[model samples]
Target: MRKFVLAAASSALLLSVSTQPVKADDDLLRLAISLCDFAKTDDRSSMRRKLKAAGMRLRAIYPAIKCGADGSLLRVATVNNAFEAAKFLASKAGDEAINAPEEDGKTLIQWTEGLVAAGDASKQQFVELYKSKM
Candidate 1:
C-alpha cells in the first residue's frame, strides 16, 4: 500500500509537470484574444494595461501569440486601421518581429509596399512606426 501511494504521488507530480506548458499556452491564448480585441477596437489604453498587468512586452510574446486570422498583433492593428495600437505594438517590436516575414510569407516592408501599390496607404503610419523600430 505504501509503495502504491508513492507511485501515485510520482504519477501526480509528473502529470502536473506535463500540464504546466498547457496552462501557459492557455494563458497566452487568452492574452492573444484580448490583445486582438483591443487592436480591433483601437483601444490602445486597454492593450497597454493588459500587457502591463501581465508584466510582458509585446516583442517578447509576439512569436508565441498569434492574433487570430490577422496573424500578428501588428497585422491585426493594420487590418483594423488601429494606428495607435499599431504604433504601440511597433514601438515594442523586436528585431525578429520587424525582420520576420509575416504569415503571407512576405516581410512587413514588402507587405506594406504591396498594400500601398494596391492603393491602400492607410497603414502608412504603422509602416513609419515599424521603420523606426527597425
Candidate 2:
C-alpha cells in the first residue's frame, strides 16, 4: 500500500513538470515573427520593443528592415527572408548556424535568392550580413 501511494505521488509530480508550458520560448517565437514584419515595414521602434520584450538582443533586424522597405521577399515570402529567418534561428539555437539549412532544405543565402533576384537591396544586404556572420 505504501509503495502504491509513493508511485502515485511520483507520477503526479512528473505530470506537473511535463505539463509546464514553455512560455518564454513561445514568446520569443512570436516576437521573431513580429520582428520579421517590422523588418519589412521599417518600424524600427516596434521592432526594438518586440525584441526587448522577448529578451532577445537585437542582432540583424536592421538589414532585414531595409530589405523590407526595399520590396524584398519580406513582402512575398510566407516566412521572413533569410535574414530574419536566420535571426530567429540564431536566437533559438545560438549564433552559430555553421552552414545549417532551414527545414525546407535551403541555406540562408539560398533562401534569400529570390529577394536578391527581385532587386531588393535589403535582402542582398542581409545575405551579405549572413555570410559575414556564418
Candidate 3:
C-alpha cells in the first residue's frame, strides 16, 4: 500500500510539472488578447495600467504579443483607428518592433503607406513616428 501511494503521488507530480509550460503559455496568450482588446477599444490607460501591473515593457514584448492579423500591436490599433492607443503603442516601440515585417512581409511603414493610399491618411502620423525611429 505504501509503494502504491508513492507511485500515484509521483505520477501526479510529474503530470502537473509537465503541464506547467502550457499554463504559462495560456496566460501569455490571455494577456496579449487583453492588450488587443484595450487597443481596439482605444483604451491606452488600461493597457498602460495592465502593462505596469505585469511589469512587462511594451518595447520588449511588442513583437511577441501577436495583437491581431497584423501581428504588431501598433498596427492593430491603427487598423481599428484607435488613435490614442496607436500613438501610445507607436511611442513605446523599439526599432526592432517598428521595422519588423508583418505576415505579408512588409515593414510597418510600407504597410501604412498602403493604408494611407487607400484613404487612411489619418495614420500618416504613425508612419511618421515609425520613420523617426528608423
Identify the candidate with maximal lDDT.
Answer: 3
List candidate 3 stretches off by more than 4 Å. Answer: 1-20
**Pairs with backbone N, CA or C atoms under 3 Å apart (clashes), candidate 2:** 39-65, 40-68, 67-122
List lDDT for all candidates, in order: 0.70, 0.45, 0.72
Candidate 3 lDDT over residue span 33-66, tens digit each: 7788888889999999988986667776666666
Q: Which prediction has the highest TM-score against the true structure?
A: 1
Per candidate, the number of residue pairs that clash is: 0, 3, 0
Model 2 scores worst on lDDT over the 10 consecutive residues at 1-10
* Estimated TM-score for each candidate: 0.76, 0.41, 0.75
Q: Model 3: clashing residue pairs?
A: none
TM-score (C-alpha) between model 1 and the true structure? 0.76
Model 1 is weakest, by summed lDDT over 10 consecutive residues, at 1-10
What digit string (tens of lDDT, one per residue) describes model 2 on residues 78-105?
2344345444434433333425454456
Q: Candidate 3 — what's its lDDT?
A: 0.72
Candidates ranked, most accurate by TM-score first: 1, 3, 2
- lDDT comparing candidate 1 with the true structure: 0.70
Predictions: Cα RMSD each: 10.6, 13.1, 11.2
